[model samples]
Target: MEVRTPWQALTRPLAYPRSVWPWRSAGYLASSVVTGLPALVVLAVLVLFSVLLVGLPLLLLAGVALGGVERRRLRIAEVAPAADPHRVPDVPGLGAWLRVRAREQATWRELAYAVLHATVLWPLDLLAIAVCLGLPAALLSAPVRLALDRQETKVVKAYLVTSYPQAFAAALLGAVLLLALLYPLAALAGARAALTRALLAPRETELRDRIGEVTRSRARLVDAFEAERRRIERDLHDGAQQRLVALTMTLGLARLDAPPGSPLGDQLAKAHDEAGQVLTELRELIHGIHPQVLADFGLGAALADAADRSAVPVDTDLDLPRLPTAIESAAYFAGCEALANIGKHSGATKARLTARYDPGPARLTLLVQDDGRGGADPDRGSGLTGLADRIAVLDGTLTISSPSGGPTLIRVEIPCPPPSA
Candidate 1:
């Protein structure tokens, strides 16, 4: 793949490779270096002559534009480094625009970018243009001169050199050296631009800020997950588990006193049956909160159980090794949600679920497909949103494709598996 870096895109293209004219190349490089400088000088000159131009109004409007430019510059700086893009704000009216410009740090940064855009980019452009074109022109000059003049095998000039052999050697050497410099100079200019943006802008601070935000988000997700789990555990243990245990004891006692098929025995059996039903529902509820199977049997088993519970006939195709609880939980839960969505809304008869681990990509991907009237819109439900959050915790991705027809597919890719332990 050909990768053109942000700095190279902005700077080098202006001068180099535009035309092969040697003097023009030199002039381009010179112009590139001076581009940002001239902008800065103009801004400064304008500041001094603001009153003369249109008093305070022109300076104020210029300042607003300068602010927008500064914001744009910062956004560029951040993105140019593969960092977060702090986009420029759209300020609607003149008053809003003025306010945005006046109130933003980004504005100043953008103005500085414009100024540096001229100062730094111009010279590099000039240099690149000069080196790329001038040496070739100098080398090729003797040949063209030979053809145009066609005077002799040897020609006399005010300088000491005259032989065709000497001219050929000189021209060839110059061309080789010129071409040799191209890559290194291009690389250096690119590096210099990166360094320049880092130094001139607040990219370092912005990176730190983005890192901190990501950390906080992760922490919040962890805390929230734990809190939800604890709440569910409390409900199951105190409310349902306790009730089921009592019912079991009661049934054991009733079984001892009563004989089979008697009226009293039948009544006790009915209560006993009710207890089991409640127990099953409670288990389902607890699993819904956070599947204990995910902890015990890993991702594959949990999804299998989900498929079993699903009302629709599910064809499960899954093969996976034991994975960490977190990864298994995310995968299992994501699958569960997708399948649950399919069961609830999909009117088709056949549904299929598959989970496979790709060790090479280091991803655990799951697919839930249904031959149903597929019209699942994420906008209408929180199930997909919560699934998104779960996968995001693992830095994974989720995608659903459900046209309003007979087939629907839900695909989830967890890029990095959780800690193996």
Candidate 2:
């Protein structure tokens, strides 16, 4: 069987020689010796020429080249392919590429691996191949050597073989040694592949890429949510709200036409009153889903409308340019929620809504404060938790400060550019 990695070959002791694993392990280690020598020469030259500043770029180039070579070599002993952690430069220029590479941790890690392979790892590879494969082959030739010399021969320079029987016995010992050494050979090769992966793999780069993807995905979800909200609002306005208005109109006309003091007249009046009430409730529900004022006139006007509708009298001092739809929606809803909470829970009879847009930082700040019995806890179903999550999607912040005595304040800040006229 063809095992991809040394570890897999190590597990099947009976099949070690019948398969290509032994030769592969030998080739992998032998190749390291060849690759390691050039690395040592290049690194040594780079260090010696450091005073000329000519070697720095060459050193980086060598490290990068060696990193590629190491990853390819890992295939001889690893089933899984090593991942490349280097990022492509955003701009296509040497200077841009260098700057990007210099900032990456992967570049330095590869350099360290190159240095270690040259100084330490290659010699180990050579020694492992020699001890595991070479000594056994020498012993297997002991009988032939004894016959040719017509005298005793030393096997591996350790065992003496004078007669044919003793020479054959030495050859048998060599065969047994070769079989025993196969497992250690596989183990050493596996360790070398693992070390190569650890040094050359781009694990940190992959993590950063994944985090960026998650952030962008979250932004997309928030955008899709807002689009759905707008669609619902449009359907209600153009379909259900218009139908209810027409129904109310029809009932009003019927009530006027009905004869006075009659049962039919009283029934028409009741139906008309019920339709008008239902229409009013539907309008409120539609506004709650997504306010039309906020979409048409922007956040400042929407805040003023919300304050006017509050049970507690609210004063407004908002000055903002039109902003991005997502920013405006989050800020408006946060304000509305704070106001609703104040009216229901806070005993404060008066509230103030203030908003301002700062051009310098491209930020919008909204504050809602009330003189009410305070001590509000978001964790206790205060509804501010959802608002905080919404603000976070825009890379914004929501803060609440409510003392036990009175004066609760809710502040929201969102980073977004002011809308163009």
TM-score of 2: 0.65
**TM-score per candidate:** 0.46, 0.65
For model 1, the stretches where C-alpha displacement exceeds 4 angstroms are 1-201, 216-220, 223-243, 251-274, 417-421
Highest TM-score against the true fold, candidate: 2
Reference-based TM-score, model 1:
0.46
Local accuracy of candidate 2 as per-residue lDDT tens digits, 217-285: 988898899999999989999999999999999999999999999999999999999999999998898
Instruction: Provide the lDDT at 216 for model 1.
Output: 71
lDDT digits (tens) for residues 1-421 of candidate 1: 2234434433445454442322222333344444446465766676678658643444444544543343344332223433322343453576765666556555455555555555565556566656665555566566666656665333223322356776787578667767556545545445544554453445665776688789778857765775678577768968878879788778968866998889989888887888878887887677677766676677788889989988888999999888755567778878878877777888768799998888776788899999999888888984898888778777788898888885888889876543364
Q: What is the C-alpha lDDT of each candidate?
A: 0.65, 0.89
